[model samples]
Target: MTSRTLLRLAMAGAVVAGSLTALSVPAQAGNAPKTVPVRLLALNDFHGNLEPPTGSSGRMVDENGNTVNAGGAVYVAAHMKALRDANTIEVAQGDLIGASPLISAAFHDEPSVDFLGKIGVQVSAVGNHEFDEGYAELRRIMFGGCHPVDGCSPAGPWKGAKYDYVGANVLFKNPGEKTDVTQSLSANPQVKTLLSDWGVPALPPVSIKWMNGVPIGFIGLVTQTTPNIVTAEGIKDLKFVDEVKAANVASKILKLFGVRAQVVLVHEGDQVTPNQSPDACSAIPGAGNRIATQVDPEIDMVLSGHSHQAYLCRVKDPAGQDRLYSQGGSFGRVITQVDMQVDTKTRDIVRSSVVADNHVVTRDVDPDSDTVTFMDFWRDKISAVANKPVGRISADITNVGTATGESPLGDLIADGQLAATKTGGNAQIALMNPGGVRAPLTYLTSPASEGDGVVTYGEAFTVQPFNNLMQAVTLTGAQLKTLLEQQFPGGPNNQPFAKILQPSANLSYTYSRSAAWGSKISNIKIDGVPVTDTQSIRVAANNFLVGGGDAFAAFKEGTDVWSGPLDIDAFVAYLGQNNPIAPPATTRITAVD
Candidate 1:
């Protein structure tokens, strides 16, 4: 028998023996209590905010409707310590890294991983951002090694993560399947053989922790829509299965191992109503609810991320059992504390006894000294590159969208991309994915202290942290129109919701909110002239969009692709050329009722 099979058999036998012992020694007069209390301290979508986030990202609304500053690695540490006990198990749903601020992103997010390890994160589900740099880079992060390109940082050689990253839904593509592999492992025969092993998951599917002699199992799953959102080149060799199916399968395996208390750490969540109490459910309709309700009844609870909303809810499982479902807000702004009692005899959680709450990582608490020192070390190392003034902004260019789904910051970024590619690719227009605009660029002086209106490299880096390369492609006006149409739901690509693309200053279009999907976009213009369907035009966008990310498959039909500088480099250069830039008009895209 295989080693895995042997291990399963051994565990089954042990469970059987334990059951017999329990039956024989029942009804003792002074035996210990039958149940043990366990605490789970959970957070998700941290995104490496070592320092307190600035502007709206750093603050959360309280139950009293007051905005309060929250979230710093130090404060998060403090809160975790204050709330945890001997029976506590700290865990995360996903997005522990990627799209981070300069302090952590500068070193390929090693500092963030180190912080999570130091704070005792035992296991985490892999987020879509974990694959931002591709699966190979993620593997390097998990297994420990210096970045092949950047080498070791001043802190010393990396020791990898102390925690386990589990992803039951991530699987390797079969041989002979089409892929967009940037670095293929196909040439290595041994590696290929290993990948072909039967029923092998890309990452560990489940992690089991024994507490008070009862095993609690955690099954990890990323969103099945991961491929549509992340860069195709990075995850080209992986296939994401349905979240519900993967969770059920993993739960069955955990059951075979005699694990009865199971929790799903899924990297998908729903948006709760704005200004709702952090601890209130009030969840809007989304995939998180579906997964919570549809997963195997054996799964006891589900913690989620990716949507970056804070909520503590009790969703009904397939068997009509109310199970705790919660998500912590992104950027360490919130923590979900779950308390439950597990029955020692059955190794199962008491569903009715579970209690969960979302706590804001408020700044009022004394920060953890160790975390402060850790943040300082990384800050000092990146100060030279991060603190330099890149440009100036006359006012705040926030990513908060208007009614038409356009934002001032998105306009600025699209304009910058267009300028960068105008001469080289002869580009007439540019478009940017709204999701890529991570943060707002405020005119006020930041913690970097570059002075009011002065934007530092670090501030700019926080706004566009992905470092995607810019590319200009040739497309027919007809194709461009189709691209805009794809932004809404129910096209050939079947977008789940509207994701309006930010347009360059020279391009403008109008769409009807009540019109059919293919017929929504109208009045397409470039340079005050209506675009002819047959006319060829050069468009600029990040490589991620050109690779058909965000369901904009029409971009893949472009020709004459001309690569340019990194998106950050282009934005920085544009800011320098246009000093004291004001927020652009948000009238580029018009919507009609």
Candidate 2:
């Protein structure tokens, strides 16, 4: 049995002492019921960044407009421990792992799970990235076992996470038909074993926490749009339900259990402000805003993630009462501290007394000793593979694309994919999706003691960590035009937001936001020649797009398909071939809006 199973078993019968002082009411009444002061520490979208992030990705603008170096498991753990007390319970919104740096991803994200356990996380919501490797893989990570393919790490079999995973809105499907709606969730093999010992369902819809004879309910949810963002194959067997409905149902269940205080942890959020302060609540808006306004009034607070931006806002519930809606910035850069007063007799929150704040995880604090020891253990295991010099750059090649969707790093990646698939795929030009570009090739970042402009395999892995295979396909000029038009804001594709694809140097096009969806792209050219409808072009793209991953359905219509090496391999090879590479000009996608 894993430590997480033991933790759950222990929690089943444990009662934590409450530190709340009794409420002072009218003297006419014999002593009024006491109000327990409860502290909830929350963080979200920590995408396995064990070390301090690099370049702009690592720095956040403070309230004073000064750049503050932020993020690192070491500092995050330190902050979490310092703020924790008898009245505090640590929790997270989601995305604790997946799309991580090589140090963690190479080990199937075990290090991240271990670090979270060490920091004393009691419960966490399931983020979309949790499904990146498929549901079965996620189960393996949660239950503790050897990797079915790679087996265990040098440290031996995995012990699983000490924290419990919750997803009230995610359900299993029976092919095209839905399963029994009335049936509660069944835990997986590991969870079954653990629950068998606790005499409860393998997977409980809500986690009930007891503190000083008071019970608090926690419900976890993911965005309904998860199907569109995650790989199709990974989530084929799962069905994502409506967030508002799921929360309402779970709230009702908790109410039946005599638990009136509730918090909803969701994996969807919005980017309110680019340089927003940790505690700022101005102009907060996004999909999360919609969900926050629609959830049941019984929910006292909603913590969110996935947008990677930070903001603290209060949305009015259906009853016209204000409730908390907040998200901590991604990558452990920020933590949300929520203080609530609960009425002991009613076991309900004194809604008006709730308060929340977002704090930056500054690098100046002394790192946590345990977090450092844990990181060093994994860092030493992969030192040779991680420290190897792959290539060099004259300056920073960032993934922050332009309004037209063209970026220097994207262009370079497209160029690399083109070079990689030239012979095997007979490719003429290449197209890269902007989302695949994770981070920049910074000249100076943490562990940059080696000096600037040096690019290592680890850094390159961080830039293109998906490991998507390179594919070449044949598309008519008209089809290629359709592909470019898909980048617009509105279309039949029903894309709520714009996602532009980066084109190789050999390809160029002009677009206008004011133009209709189908007519937005114009003057499309390949190799400096005007593209004609009758011409057939060979284009290279990562498997994600060619297989219709980012709604680029036009690529799915292509014929004469061929596959090549992984994208990371192509990028590393390109760097070696073109030593001391410079940033490419971002003139490919010209926007006329």
Compared with the true structure, what per-residue lDDT tens digits does model 2 show for residues 207-317? 767665577788888888777666777778778878887788677666654568999999998877566676787535768988888889999989999888778888899
Off by over 4 Å in 2: 1-33, 175-204, 445-448
On TM-score, the leading prediction is: 1
lDDT of 1: 0.86
- Compose the digit string of candidate 1's lDDT tens values, residues 235-340: 8878998999888877876665567899999999998889888888877859999999999999999999999888888889988899988898899999888999
lDDT of each: 0.86, 0.80
Candidate 1 runs further than 4 Å off: 1-30, 175-199
TM-score, per-candidate, Cα-based? 0.92, 0.90
**Model 1 residue 592 CA deviation in Å:** 0.6
